[model samples]
Target: MWSYITSIFGYFFKLQEDEGREKLLIEELIDLKLELEREEFHNQNIENKVQESSQQSECFQRTGFVTHCGESYILIDGSFYFDTSACSFNLNVNDKILYLGYNNSNEELVIVRILQNEGIGWENEDDSEEQRFDVINHIIVGIVDCREDRNVFIQGGDLKFNLDDVQGTFIPIAGDWLEMQCSIQKNDEKLTDINMTQVLQVTHFRPLRTKIKSGTVTEWSGKVGIIDNQIYFDSSTFIETFIPQVGAKIKYLRLIFNAMGLPQPKIGTVEEFQGQERPIILITTVRSTESLIQQDIKYTLGFVNSPKRLNVAITRAQISMILFCNPHLLSTDSLWNEVIMNAVNNNRYMGCYFPIEEK
Candidate 1:
């Protein structure tokens, strides 16, 4: 009888334990259902916000010539300036293009796509007649005037030529002096029109030089001397320690080469120089800021962390290549670190003494 009583108490204890487990399981199921509902509510809110934002933004398409193409913005029709950071293709001045644009919630103009680019070139597809023309090389000086219609006019004395008549990749702003080589069209040995075939030089200031003999100088005052009433010379005229204050290195190089009457080297982006080989190539990796390095690595901005782009950029030179970059920033990536190590092992690495600041 005692054993039976003990067994009954044991059975009752087991039943209570099973009931406790079931209650705990039901509570856990309720908590899980609540979490799922919360997650679904959060997703629905995000979808609603996205739909509303899409409705608020306005999108449109337009056709116009690019009047000004800057580093981050492109001016179309001489009025609207759109952000070009998202554009895949490079834009140039006076390019007839069709683009898709939209205004964001902040009312900022954004460029979505570049549909077409009919660049300014002297080629007629409809004209099939082979007209023979002589190539007469002559230099002419003029002042540039950019018009609202995306037309660049060069006016000097009584001469004026349209933008289509000029041939060069350089686009000058208004009031700048342009020295170009052109061919005056001749019909039957008589000049019919003055048309510019090529642009050789462009400058902002007019070049003036005066020559004087030493014997022609009559009087001298302090550091200034007047010679033959035509020219004056001072201590500043002779450069003791010449240092050019230039904002851009490439432009300064171009100016130096043009002054010496030498052929200018081609300067273009990596994408533009693809499939083209050069004897000497200089690559400028413009990212040097410590703060931006992390962002660049995360997004693969530029050649950093991008193996294919880095390979293409480094292999373009057949003879020699000079790469300018910050080793401290680029060494964060394995690929770039390998390149740096290779250069150091080859004894070809040259480092700057001072810190490189972001430009």
Candidate 2:
């Protein structure tokens, strides 16, 4: 009888000990989670500081017309004298240039040839079409109406291209632009015995997409609250939700609505924000398709594949950049995978698929 009683006591004691250990483990896990969150916040703050400092160090690109030039310096718009020491070529008065250099101690611009210029009466219309033809940047306007194959037309200044042989990663649309290298070549067949000029192959097509993809619609209040310095929607759907009716006025801001009635923040797609910067940016990577991996891959994968677009998205943030995305989905791509790895290494990443070190 004593042995039986002792055995029961021992079992109860073991049960109590097991329960105590389990409680201790739960407490430890909670502590670890809180610590990780703090670490992630700290790491992200550090990255923001580094980015801000780096941007402050570099000079922003500027465009102004040259008013005059001395033997040593080029005067821009009769106000600023930019150092011409590094200019391999000479600049005359009234010349327009894109200058990419920093201001010196005297607050004068020291420039190099990051320039693009178009002067008054630069081209003569009387000149032969072939003579006027040269390679340059251009924007797609619309498709030309023809009984033959539908050909897209592009225009830049006096230059125009009937892009019959157009091919690109994305479909050609009106307002899409590209920086191309082109030339005018005479066609063998003549129009009424007159030699006809045609635009040659567009050697380079800059990947530009202005059309916003469809984004997941969040609560109305959530969208409204997020309106700040700069907001980037991964799609047009999200944009529509916030700015529902065109020209419909609602009061939360001191802002007036445009004809389109969009918010004050610079709202655009990831692709449209190329070569653009903002003090703060929020990127919402929306995934709403049923086949999340396959269908969304067309759009989401595009973001991951193009290094240029990624570069623009990341570097645009001068102060801070917040990415609203499912890391697991993004991790499938190589570029995004690298980002994940970097975030993990820096202790900035948090997700279910990857292991987080408690230490």
Candidate 3:
């Protein structure tokens, strides 16, 4: 009986040891869970701080106009010149822009983006007047209708304007595509009227027989001409090519035509040609280097990577659109790749390889 009692005491001691071990394990698990919670809270705080910093940076953006554009620098508001090394796109004088920099330091200024080209704003001569009128300029495209002597009109998509209200030297011709630069008058922030300042271009309407053509950069000679009522592209022709190295693309085209003794045709940037249609449009994708592929994709600045810009550039033509680009470089972007594939499927793609294959 005494031996039986000693065995029972030994069993009790073993039970107590097991309970102690379980308690210690529970405490350790609680501590680990608390540490995990603290870590998550710390990470969330860091993210919040980063977001706050980004918001503060955006708040510092300022508005200004480019008064002069040089090779290495651009003058803003005719007061300060900023370095252009960081700029991704070409800048021209009279471009209203938004910028980021310290108001007190001209050296720290950088242009962020262009607001508009050739912006015009006028207020009353009296500085203390509470009322104001704002004039904004726009480039518009529409189809002309000369059905009635007093009701001559131009209609484009959903917008229509009476030609009688517009002041320009253009004599309205029926079935012509009209592109005009006009001014919108706004009084107290309300749109009052639109007036055509100049007739930029006019193209006669033709029956839609669309043809797409693409060529390699090596084969681009900028030669364009018309034969038998159809436009032709030849690399060895005497007519000057429209190459936009700086300033406006239309300006370059005009200069080339003047040099070749041909009347200048209407040519403008994709941005300028929005809401406009033409019988023929030629687009040049200027980015060709392999080294710039990743950089251009990251920034979405040029034709190779900017899908929206490519869409705008290709869709502006109603009859024929000629595209000149390096096929290898354009294939790096998905949208551009689709464009090449579409052309290839239609048997419209024309490619040429470099004399020496690039490494």
Candidate 4:
């Protein structure tokens, strides 16, 4: 009876010498599914061939944390890989470094420092942390809230700490992923706040730099003492930017404007302004409470809310920065709130009935 059952099973599964019955069944099922589907649609107009690269010449410095330090290559921001065979600095992972490099055709960074020893933690530190720990344990915590130069509230597991002694060099913002050696005390009778003595590591899960097209054009005109300067506009304000739209037509008007001898500011998106700096920077924040497009707020406001983008935008100005934004909209972000508050404290804020004090 066992032999009869074996023959019946063998008839159904017809396995080859090299293949198993389950593998054959899976292949047959996949073939059936593929047969049911129609051919993928491809547009002939859109070339399928890989195109040769074209990226603008960049001459700007970028700041990024060393996410990885390999034997031959150093990875910055988890994406930018640089050959560090010639690097003089003994770099390590998590070291915040300023690198001046340009994007290659393959989108790799070619690092050659224009500025020397511009890494973070290069400044002098005088403040000392005083935390007397009764017990210590390695744990992970969720950042509930954070204030620069103040205590942080974190909650996760049994380890709850109002961390006042976070390392001054490493600060984690709200919603940041934090792992640290926690200084805690557990009462046999009760539970209390777990004191975090020192923050071991801070990892920000913020979005990477979006490569959305910034509509900027740079033109060069051979002239003595007078050169054509291109100005890049922020993406959030790009739609409402009148200067960039007006600046595009300035190429034709360069000769006309130069004959009149005016300071012509050509306009493009901020990505286009990467390697260039100007004497004046005019930024507009177009988002407002009155009018809002229902979309990914992170993506929409990414251009303005980013530290790197802000650093680029602000530092490009050699002397002055003129900002135009609805404070009501700008205050929606915590980072922007601090910026607006700073402006308010300094009396630099110029807006009608904004919730500056409330923020």
Of 2 and 4, which scores higher on TM-score? Answer: 4
**Model 4 lDDT per residue over 276-336, tens place:** 8888888776555544523425465543446666666666788888877777766766777
TM agreement with the true structure for every prediction: 0.30, 0.27, 0.28, 0.28
Taking all chains together, the TM-score of candidate 2 against the true structure is: 0.27
Off by over 4 Å in 2: 1-263, 288-290, 297-302, 350-353, 356-359
Error of 4 at 335 (Å): 1.4
Off by over 4 Å in 1: 1-252, 352-359
Q: Against the unseen true structure, what C-alpha lDDT does each candidate score?
A: 0.53, 0.47, 0.49, 0.45
Candidate RMSDs in order? 28.9, 23.0, 26.6, 28.6
Top TM-score prediction, candidate number? 1
In lDDT terms, how accurate is model 2?
Answer: 0.47
Local accuracy of candidate 1 as per-residue lDDT tens digits, 192-307:
12333222111112221111112244335545543332122343332444322212111122322332233457776687777889999999888888888767768877667788
Against the true structure, candidate 1 reaches a TM-score of 0.30
The most accurate candidate by lDDT is 1
Model 3 spans with C-alpha error above 4 angstroms: 1-253, 259-262, 353-359
| Residues 1-359, model 2: lDDT tens digits | 99999999999999999999999999999999998797667544543443343332333346667777788787775677665543444577666565544443476664434345545322222321111111212122222122223444443222233355333333455655443322222222321111111222332233422322122223233223112211112223234445533233333221211101233477778877777889899887665333556654466564645667677777889897777677766666678677667778886765466744322
